[model samples]
Target: MKQKRFGIDIDGTVTCPTSLIPFINKDFSLNITLDDIKKYDLSEALDIPAERCQDWFNEREPDIYWSSPLAEGAKDVLLKWKEQFQLFFISARRSHLLDLTQKWFETKDILYDRIELIGSHDKIKAAKQHKVDIFFEDKHDNAVSIHEELRIPVLLFNTPYNQDPVPSGVIRVDNWAQAEQWVKAWIDSESFIQQ
Candidate 1:
């Protein structure tokens, strides 16, 4: 049997984007807490026209993705999963971060088949093009959209701002350990039945 294909997100899923928040807060310097950073509506804080904010985000793309640190166990879990599935990173971290993100993966020695860095808020189209079977993501809106449209099973990685209730059929997991076990059990059960 062929191995399943997984579409994984970068920020807040495989890695924590906390570093970017500090940058954003320092640039704004509103004495914001981490929670405030997480809960902040970028549109409101930036207080700019939509197109201008888009431009600003594009300009600051590097500061966001490259500064993040990988989540705990993300490297190990991904390495283990590489043995059972084809891993593809489907991130909304802009095209500029392609080289940086790839270098980050190389440093971690993560063996993924592909890495896609789409612009922010355009993951669903990218995932559809990739034919991703399952996805692990941390963004609530993205998860809901992907799950609703593609009906793909998404393992939601818990995050402060993403604590909104997940729709039915979407699995919510606290950490990568639980995610690894869930995938392993499913694969093992399939193997057993085939035997």
Candidate 2:
């Protein structure tokens, strides 16, 4: 059997979606929780200007990424999958953060076959280049887009900000445990089809 390659997003998928909330609240002096973020744009959620939010993010991106915690159940599942599947981390983080990203992964004890930091939300190109059998993402449009474009299933990690409706190919998983269940079923069905 050929090993499946999974294209996964870093932030909000592997890391907790609310990883930046405390930082945002502290920096902005507003006690807003993850549920308060209705939109993917932090500025919109905070009702602040976009540029100001961008500036803050740029200044604190390293610290934020360095300290972000893994999502619940992510470590166990990913570690198990590492022995069978080819894990490729495709993130919207900039290329300059490769060292920091690798360090973060090491600190978290996560293993990967590859990591691509594309610096933009549009991940279709990277997904295609990696030839991933499936994808995992936290962004709503990104999940829909990667599935629609690549003709592959995309597991969307559910978040308050990504409550928008998704296509049939985009499976919504509330946590890594659910994600593991879905992947097992998908692999079984695919194997059956091949046979």
Quick one: best TM-score, which candidate? Answer: 2
Give all candidates' CA lDDT scores: 0.78, 0.95
Q: Give the TM-score comparing model 2 with the true structure, all chains together.
A: 0.99
lDDT of 1 by residue, 1-195 (tens): 777889998878888646566766666565655465444356554564667656766787776766667888888899888987889899877686789889888877888999998877668888888888888988788888889999988888876667777788678888999999988887788789989
Error of 1 at 112 (Å): 1.1
lDDT of 2 by residue, 1-195 (tens): 899999999999999998998899899999888888999988888899999999999999999999999999999999999999999999999999999999999999999999999999999999999899999999999999999999999999989999999999999999999999999999999999999
- Whole-model lDDT, candidate 1? 0.78
Which whole-number lDDT from 0 to 100 does residue 87 have in model 2? 98
lDDT of 2 at 100: 99
Name the TM-score of candidate 1: 0.84
Query: Once all C-alphas are superposed, what RMSD does model 1 give against the true structure?
Result: 2.7
